[model samples]
Target chain A: MPSSEEVFEKVQAALMDALGVDDDEVTPEATMVGDLGAESIDFLDIVFKLEKAFGINIPREELFPDDILTNSSYVKDGTVTADGISELKARLPWADLSKFEKNPRVQNFGNLLTVNDLCRYVESKL
Target chain B: MRWFWIDRFEEFVVGKQATALKNVTYSEEPIDDYLPGRPHYPHSLIIEGMAQTGGILIAQMQDFHPKVVLAKIGKAEFNSIVVPGDQLRMTAKLMSLQSDGAIIEGHVTVNHQPLAEMELAFGILDDSFGDTSFFLPGGFFRILRSLRLFEVARHEDGSPIQIPDYMLEAVRQEAAQ
Candidate 1:
């Protein structure tokens, strides 16, 4: 399988193909529905991308149902906040420990992480 | 929503089938941010729609308890991108099950044109360490039904299909003394 970064890039490319969007569009900040006008079909494409990229199962619950809710700040481990910013912090000083983590739309989609997020974790391990 | 509604189980007793519809609306919040007139429906939502179909049935299988988390997705194929205003008709059928997980086959079609579809295996996990959380009033099931979205149908003949005997056996978790 490709490295985590490679997998993310693959997902990015696949989503681009599925959405007919430019490569620059799929940033971490972009919500699948909110930022990309992605309906259910495009999302399914992303899952296919993620599954192929990472070699794992992404069940329905793996990806949060509502677009807005998936992007919003969530309480992780029932304590720490897991918005994107905090997500960056959580990775550096150890991936998780009460400090909330970004719940990747990454159910068993392999590694329980998004491309960039997985990259960060991989980097942290070094 | 992403999953397209096709039909509902009106005749089936144990097994049920349902359909969802996903219209790629131009006015969705995301389009405004994109440059020009580019628009498309996100893919994950489609699966959720299918999952909702499967999820609801799983809930029905489990008597709507111990919420079924999508345990696994197998062999998903994207025939094409689903766009706004495109009528996507989705269908889900009970495949198989075990004490730990279930397999359901679902597909997505737009104007009868196949777009994306997959055969999914979902697991009913305990509330601990799982995404398939039970009692999610705001979850997919409520949203789809309350909104009166999806054409709820159980079988191909506009009738409910009998629940697969094995699924009934697997779903019976309480164990009789």
Candidate 2:
């Protein structure tokens, strides 16, 4: 049971190791895809480094999850409905989405993921 | 006996994972027989390509001293079809490694589109299994050399892998010929 600070350090290190980015680019608010420039391919590399660094098994599905936006149960129109927002909130509790909650789009859900979110997820797993 | 599935490896990290790429071409013999009119790469062969990508990684993890065999395919699901002219990028990651064997999880994609996913298990045949020629055929080494696999491969800590003696011998012998 490592402290949150410890987890944050490991997470930052994993990101740096996987993406080869500078130390300054890995702030907690940095989004993996946006700020860190993580493509879909980098996700596997990131997960692998995290698993090795923390000695914890991180399933790919648990991290990004399936694109539930395509399923009718969550999305009725192009925009995410109340049910969809609830599902997103439940799935991504670590994300700070007060801004996203105002108007959520199915496609933009990926944008909500953040570096802090990853650290929080790791903490929860521990 | 002959390795044909894996064309080359793009990335290989010893004891960690590997990413290999195979090009599905109509010039291949199997394509002539598979689906007469609408030619498509066999899903089975695609899976085999993934197996080779992972199998080689698993074997190399232990320096290829033990015989590695595909014991089982725990799961494989094809999401889309692969046709000629498409390049398949297959990545295999070590799930678990133990004394007896190893488990690997693999995924294949074409131009970033998901093609298939698989979970494979491999058995490492130890010396007690009887007189086993763990050394691969000379031709296999030739293919590996052509692909420059050794040049790109690295240990988990990013250090260069010391090419095994038998492999070096085979390469040396093949080069002399």
Top candidate on TM-score is 2
> Per-residue lDDT for A39-82 in model 2, tens only?
65466556766787888887655776456677788777777788
Predictions' DockQ, in order: 0.03, 0.02
Can you give the lDDT of residue B132 in candidate 1? Answer: 51
Could you tell me how far off, in angstroms, the CA of residue A9 lies in candidate 2 after the best superposition?
36
Clashing pairs in 2: none
TM-score of chain A of each: 0.47, 0.90
Once model 2 is optimally superposed onto the true structure by TM-score, how far is the C-alpha of residue A24 displaced, in angstroms? 55
- Please identify model 2 stretches exceeding 4 Å from their true place: A1-126, B134-137, B170-177
RMSD for all candidates, in order, please. 13.7, 16.9
**Weakest 10 consecutive residues of candidate 1 chain B by summed lDDT:** B5-14
CAPRI verdict (incorrect, acceptable, medium, high) for model 2: incorrect
Q: Name the best candidate (by DockQ).
A: 1
lDDT of 1 by residue, A33-92 (tens): 545666543455555555555566555442432322334354333333346434434323
